[model samples]
Target chain A: MTSLLALGILLLTAFLLLVVALLTRNSTPRFREIPALTRLVRTLGLSVEDGKRLHISLGHGSLLDERGGSAFAGLAALRIITEKTSVSDMPSVASAGDPALGLLTQDTMQAGYQAAGVEELYVPTTSRVTGLTPFSYAAGAMHIASNENVSTNIMIGHFGPEAGLLADISDRDYVTLIGASDNLAGQSVLYASTQDALIGEELFATGAYLGAGTSHSASLTVQDILRWLIIITLLGGAAAKFVGVI
Target chain B: MRVLTAVIAIAVGLMVLLGYFFAEFVGIQTLLLNWAVILAGVASLVGIFNLIAVHTDKVRRAEKGGVYSALLVIALVATFVFGLILQPQHQIMQVLLNGIILPVEATLMGLLTITLLYAAIRLLRRRADVMSVFFIITAVLIFLGSATLPTGDVPVIGTLIRPWVSQIWALGGARGILIGVALGTLVTGLRVLFGIDRPYGGK
Candidate 1:
């Protein structure tokens, strides 16, 4: 009950903030640039222009679990990527470990193509369930990344340490890799392996950075406010503990 | 069509969310989740067919890796036939798991260590920034502390510094990241609920 109430409050706060942000959207909002996202956006354009395929590896995360958050974020990123690259000679492809995520990737890609008025060009097989298990997923994705004429590989989702294999393959192939994951070991592996690696909440900001919509930017504000609240609560609790107030 | 899809999605999502707080919604939530599970199972079948189709097309086109695709198709069909006939609990199926799947997965897992080591070396060569140096040092310290020297444990590095770094600093940082991730999840869920973002083929 207490947890429910807390969740309610957080949701309410976020909704209200989102409304405020949407209502006050006359001017362009300024945001501190994320170098990784900046590089990703530039690479998207370059890949399209160079007629090179872009491979997006949405890691093995099911929507039924907590790991689904990053998977959803990855789907959002895929939507944006598909929209941007819909007209390219070599359309972008996405791979997922979970069939549910793969299904959504197909839906998201189709929606993206529909939005771009290129629905006829959308291929359902472009977004595939590459494998069922983690290592198989990484191995399958590595094959796509290395063999598909992919100049840029963007991996965002719930990856484990097995992501290292994907990174190693991308490195060997000289493909530009931008990776992120909600898992700690995955983050560590990606950070060590990839030049541009999003850590923690940065993965969630993919939509906003890639211009998914104003709502994405608004949600980022809510995240920022909630993060600061958490930090303050942590510090206050620590202080109280230090002073034996508990 | 888009509006209808969005309505159904939001309704189902709310029912599931409310199931946590209100007992009345639990029955409906369970029903919906069961349906989702069935759908997911069907989707997996569809995905398998798609995989087969992709490989078949590769073989048909005589692509560069067509031979491997042919092998994969054969292996997939053979395994499916064996599993269907013998059942997964049968000895032959167990042999497939124990002899083939487990060992293959284990070998891949073993490769990760070498991959990570090579990545760390490359990281040092590529970016020797302050954060990179700190990360390398922290990783090294943790590894050293976890290892037992043939003689005994190291002194301060193992006893004091590693404990402080891992227990305090690393834990604190991890918690911070987790909180941020949770907030992000909440916001993303709300966005979907409110129809601001529709990943379900809704406009």
Candidate 2:
């Protein structure tokens, strides 16, 4: 019974996202996340004269694998951060494990910063290519986190169990922390977030809210509806199950 | 011919993807899974060949770790023979690996944690800000909550935190983070599957 409910929710969520993605693809890409993040940026200290560094990692997925697309989300997040950070004269640093992702992440950040009218805020060296091993990559990230003196760390992409280790260590040690990752372990780290903002679906909402492109905004609107439908169905199912209804 | 390759790929792809939802289609699903396993097993030989080629080149060049490579060969041969000759549950082989090798990795990880802890402490010394305060408070809370030690014996402290700690640490903060992460993951997955933002060279 529980299995059936879970499957139902999964299918419904997928369906909703599919519809929304299709509808909004050509209109505007940045949807829900832009305003919130822009407000967050305005709320932050741009007057301090240096833009905060942003770190975005596309998890352990291989760029070489034909199936790999985890890093793409990181590229997307880079665009928003780039635009916002640049306009405010706040610097953003983005990094990737795959060399391919490294190229894309830097390009996107540069584009966003250029849009924001603060091209200097985009530092190319910040988007690094590291060793392929998950732990080795994590170690490289840890080093960069310490060295760069970044104000916000944003992670968006696929992650594994090792992600928790980095999140825990980063939060425990550094004063600069803005974490966003799809890794299950990231939740534990994010839950502990105090000074920095750890966004949820808000990252997906970015493309639409910012009006970056059509497909992006549409996806967010669909995701919002889908998320609520899931909650309602699950709640209804639970209630029915308690009353002994199938 | 190219079209045939593409056709086969899409057909097999749908089966692999859809199999997750329709486990009731047992026969077809099992055949695909079994074939995947077999292919993976065959591919393991490729990795072994690569390892040998690299190590042989290292040994021939008398690289810095060439002796370590030589020792690895000796250990690999011995362990393979011992493993095949002896049952897995046999005492000696288990003892050597479990007793020695396991501890080494564990100790190294433990050492890394300790050094990491020290670095965090030092960072706190340098910059005493909002982010630092949040991180320290949360780490201590989680660590203390998970610890099963003689701390419960302490009258004022353990009793005070025991019940509420779970609510404060585990339920409140943990649940929020979990929901955020789940949402992020779901969005990411949708983005990939739909090719809205293709990182992979898309068709």
Candidate 3:
């Protein structure tokens, strides 16, 4: 079992390296002076708009945060947002529940805007610590998802059942909500939305999705290949064990 | 160099993964896991220090809502005292965490359900769309299915609905979502692998 699991890990690592190599061959994310999201909002929406809003929810973090990799996903997601949405001068609203997460998220969002050269759009009040409760967090997110003016709500991180309600509410309001939750129920909400679900490690794969940077995306891709390899290896091992092939 | 960190990380991950079924490898994995826990406990002090610094500075500046900072301090100290003063194995800390924090968190979470219900009911009300209505039906049915399974009054009905929704969701919707999420993760990881993103630098 250990060998199989390790084999999965090895396979994932190799795949990640491959993805990294492939992406590096292409251009990485470049922050535009004006957010491209503005075009989407201005041309797509009614008359005038405050531009699109990118909502990023950093998960509760992992049992092992030695390097803070879990929270790193949220921060990386913000980076990609900064690169794309602000190319034509748009805004993004971010909020968090965990204080530590709140602090980190604030920095990342601000950094995102700075990278895009539109730090002016970063809202201080919007990046508040929603609540100490899942419900309160849900309540706060629902407000963002359903409110007018905000175009795209990229909901990511550690979410629960209320997350489904929040994601569904975005579609209800004709707003686009890219929901990514780590939990099973939260994942189910993704399926309920106009888009498909982004669950588990996908929550941390934001950087790759938006073409933000390379390393994180590479690691994520590698994990996927590794996952499948692990699955196949299991069958191989089962056969071996059954026939005493070792 | 990034290579060193990447290599070590992959090595550790592989060892841990291998340790899953291999008893011999389990020893090293357990040790590494313990090291991880110890690291977490140690790094938590950074958070504690940050809290202290932020609140202390707020109290010193006497800023608006600084009193709330004081309250936070009070809460932290009170909780810590109760935790350390009581027997190490006692439920005192657990009581505080569960009794006080849990209820507040749970109530707040429960409140979202109302909003969720509203969002579900109002999904198609204000929109000029059919997909919104489709979403509404799916949301309502899923909600009802979930809400009903908990009552436990009708064992037969509960038994039927539980697996029904579970499989429908797991095999149907969940599987699809998993694929997207998987693809997204793969892409993101690839970007990272190529140094397209440097998350380690606090960006």
Question: Which stretches of model 1 miss by more than 4 angstroms?
Answer: none
Model 3 stretches with alpha carbons more than 4 Å out: A1-13, A16-20, A27-56, A63-72, A80-154, A162-178, A187-205, A214-246, B1-25, B52-67, B87-95, B125-131, B142-165, B179-198, B201-203
Error of 1 at B146 (Å): 1.0
**Model 1, position A164: C-alpha lDDT score:** 96
Best by lDDT: 1
For model 2, residues A1-246, the per-residue Cα lDDT tens digits are 766765676666667667766665555343223333564455334423554455556665544342143355556656765665564443555555554455555566666766667666655554555434466456556554655555555566655444545565566655444455544354333434323434455544544443446556555565567667657877899999999997
DockQ of each: 0.72, 0.12, 0.20
Top candidate by DockQ: 1
Give residue A116's error in model 1 in angstroms.
Answer: 1.5
User: What does chain B score (TM) in every candidate?
Assistant: 0.94, 0.66, 0.67
TM values, all candidates: 0.96, 0.54, 0.61
Cα lDDT of model 3 by residue, A211-241, tens digit: 5445554455456565676568778999999
Candidate 2 on B124-183: residue-level lDDT in tens? 664567867776775666566556686453443445554466666546655654555455
| lDDT digits (tens) for residues A128-207 of candidate 1 | 88889999888889888888899998999999999999999999999999998999999999999988789999999999
Error (Å) of candidate 3 at residue A213 is: 3.7
Give the C-alpha miss distance for residue B8 in model 2, angstroms.
Answer: 6.7
